[model samples]
Target: MDNYRFILSGGGTGGHIYPAIAIANELKERFPDAEILFVGAKDRMEMEKVPQAGYKIEGLWISGVQRKLTPKNLMFPLKVISSLVRSASILNKFKPHAVIGTGGFASGPLLKVASVKGIPCLIQEQNSYAGITNKLLADKVKKICVAYEGMDKFFPKDKIVKTGNPVRSDLISLSENRDNAMQFFNLDMDKPTLLVLGGSLGARRINELIEDKLSFFKTFGLQLIWQCGKLYYEEYKKYDSEEVKVYPFINRMDFAYTATDMIISRSGAGAVSELSIVGKPVIFIPSPNVAEDHQTKNAKALVAENAAVMIAERDLDTEFEEDFTDLMLTKNRQQELSDNIKRMSLPDATKRIVDEIEKMLGKG
Candidate 1:
């Protein structure tokens, strides 16, 4: 183990990409001299993001199979075989000590090749409802790190480690910055602040819903910090004013979390995990566009625990105002959601996943 080398694979979306980057970061911190390489789908976000995170990455020609039969489905087999061949080539050359996957088309082939090569591998499953890639590789990997309970339904119980998803470390510690946060956002602390996140690219339904309720929000006496996302900033920038501060993206997310009293967001696994750490009463608007309606399922997990509220994208027109009104006025309900979500947070998840990796290498 003198020259520890590791390969991480995942992509397609931020959900799959960030966790791999987070784990790679932690491994770099612990083993400063170790070589960490990333493998991601060629055209996906990870090729850019991984490099931004200061790691070299190799791309595989890969994409997920479409749900409905279409022309793209014909390319599926060729893509998989090509990806498998490419992944095998990379594995042979890198000769990685361990390969880690965070669930995407690229990871499927990369981890499968590594496993066949007798390399120990691990996967971090972000959602309560496991993704197809992770499920397929469950038995092949040495360990399965998950963000939710009962993932035994997907992976072997003996192999599953209940480590929550890794989030930006800066987000985990900001409790002492409230006063500075308020000033930074130029927000008045007298009004109850609502933070709205539509994710980095922005959710179309959430943006439209916010547009429909702008006047009503002011009537409800709430100030807002809205992240309309980079994709829809121009469409929603008109809403920005004294009471509603709108941005394409909030780079200073820790400050945004600190300044706000409550959150209205899309309940992707990453958002759910970060919100749990922020310990705010959150109203989730899960995107219906995702595969298997997983966002709604992710939100339902917290709703079951009384840790969050949810309004389906289709139900937003009918349920948004009423549910938000009741939650906003009910002080005790707010506290209950906040406290319970905090209990669900796993701030040490990155460290825990790295611990499991070390154990696999007989270094634990």
Candidate 2:
């Protein structure tokens, strides 16, 4: 009974992929002999990341349907059919005890096939707003684990569990990492540090805003640990200096979090979840291009509770400086935001999710 087999399917973005990995890690820790597999879209970040995490992964020939009438849209049906067939074959071979989905196009076909085959299935929805894929699979899955309340609006009331999002284990305890983090990032302990995260792929608007305000930030004697993302690294590398350390991607987020005093980031669910644990003062500039403006809704939820600050992309030009200055200059305000956000952190989220998995599999 301890030797459970599970398939974790989700990808397309780090928000979805990292949660799956965290869950997989927790499962491995609990059942050391468990056989875990990952299913993700071919050519996506998960294909690379999952392997890097020391797990086997199979890639589906799949991608999300584009909003516009493009050639890829024409191939959507074909892709879906192909993914379903492959999923069925994989399930037949693995005969997993259960399947867990995070949220992405790849998870849709795999979870559907697994559920139809009578395998117990569960899904974790990281965002406050439900994703289209999770919404479609809600009725089929046995349990829906979610980070935010009011998810009953999208899922069956009886099946929903508020377990929060699964953040990486390394991020759970950062209080002891400040000195090591500062040394690793070559940051001065005397001056305040600002961490800039634009999610996994970098935000063009956020990057532009940072580039524009470099001098203004320097005026306050603030040092920066800027993660401009891989795509924009070349364009922004010229700005890297002693006071500003520019990275294409931050591999050591634990260090990044521990070294920084404040953060300016995209309000993607994964970022929001991780930031809560880091417990730093944050100004969320949610990405507007996402589906249904989910990022804005995520940021607003925290702002409503006075857990964080938010400035929309449209209002950045006029409001960003004033907002950033106020947050930076006020110590009491920073501590208040930090305290409130930390109170919102579910540091045991990964374990709770794994507990749900154990119960579903009758292994608890």
Candidate 3:
């Protein structure tokens, strides 16, 4: 009996869930006989997403602590205690050979328990600024896999491995049939296409900026493929027309990347990784709502190296039109960003992460 169990934990958002699944899928490919269990916070998107990915999952009664006063926060301590207990029970029953966390509230408790059991654990920090959960669990975990540099300030220098964030495999190697992608999107091949993405749930500021400036997009003879995200679809769909295709979600990211000449998007770690691989000229609008303003930091790292352009969310009202128009007109600037960002890409992140996992388990 191989009896080697692997426990993968992360939730709350696609950034955390997808990476955990990517790592789990890679592990299963290498060790088909190993048992795998996913642990996520109850009622989060992961409870649904993980199962859909063909993995068994358990949900912890855990929630993030509120930064401000709220009635719901009254149960924070209780939830934490219950989650810790549940995590220990799950670890006892599963008896995992190793545990992996990709930065989420549920991962904190689950990996903490795994660490206490003397099991080998790996933490994947996807952002330029470390997430609170991963930061808290840094010392406890045996290995820290990260996507950005200068992370020694967040985790132990010895434990850090600069494995770039894992993106969907297809995204790394885009199937370069641009004509086919254009046909699929019903877009003109001659016009420069702009792809605007606000992630799975959407960004309010980005959506508003696009709606406000949509009329201006036509002036440049540019076509638009907009992912408005599910949250803002109803409000933004009214603006969609023949030249502007508005989608709430895009499952075929490879096609999306291929069909576009330029991209306007939030600077989430996952989006940044995918963009680096696609090597398109990008205008980043980092969300202000994230913890520690990590998205801005992620964008700044790229901008510092001339890899991309960033417009702070608050500055969008004043600078978006000018910045966007300048980029569209300047072919030299676009090519420069494309070339520099491609230099920062790590398309084999999934392989690197899996290799580390295998090494930690002494199976390499």
Best by TM-score: 1
Measured with C-alpha atoms, the lDDT of residue 223 in candidate 3 is 91
Q: What lDDT tens digits, residue by residue, belong to model 2 across residues 1-364?
A: 5798999999999899999999999999989999999999999989999999999999999998889899999999999999999999999999999999999989999999999999999999999999999999999999999998888999999999999998878888875567898889898889999999997679999999999999999999999999999999999999999999999999888889889999999999989999999899999999999987999999999998899999999999999999999988899999999999998999899999999989898766
Cα lDDT tens digits, model 3, 1-364, are 3457999999899999999999988888877898999999999999999999999999999999889999879999999999999999999998899999999999999999899999999999999999999999999998999998899999999999999999888877787699999988899889889999999888888888888787899889989999999998998888778789999999888888999999999999999998999999999999899889989999999999999999998888889889988998899999999999999999889889988988888877
Instruction: TM-score winner between 1 and 3, please give it.
Output: 1
**TM-score against native, each model:** 0.98, 0.96, 0.97
Residue pairs clashing in model 1 are none
Candidate 1 per-residue lDDT, tens place, 1-364, comes to: 4369999999899999998999998998899889999999998899999999999999999899988999899999999999999999998898899999998889999999899889999999999899999999998989999999988989999999999999999987876577888888888878889999999999888889888898888887889999999999999999888899999999999899988889999988899999999999999999989887899999999999999999987788888899999998899999999999999999999999999999999998
Number of colliding residue pairs in model 1: 0
TM-score quality measure for candidate 3: 0.97
The CA lDDT at 72 in model 2 is 97
lDDT of 2: 0.93
Of the two candidates 2 and 3, the one with more favorable lDDT, higher being better, is: 2
Q: Name the top lDDT candidate.
A: 2
Instruction: Give me the runs in candidate 3 sitting further than 4 Å from their true place.
Output: 1-3
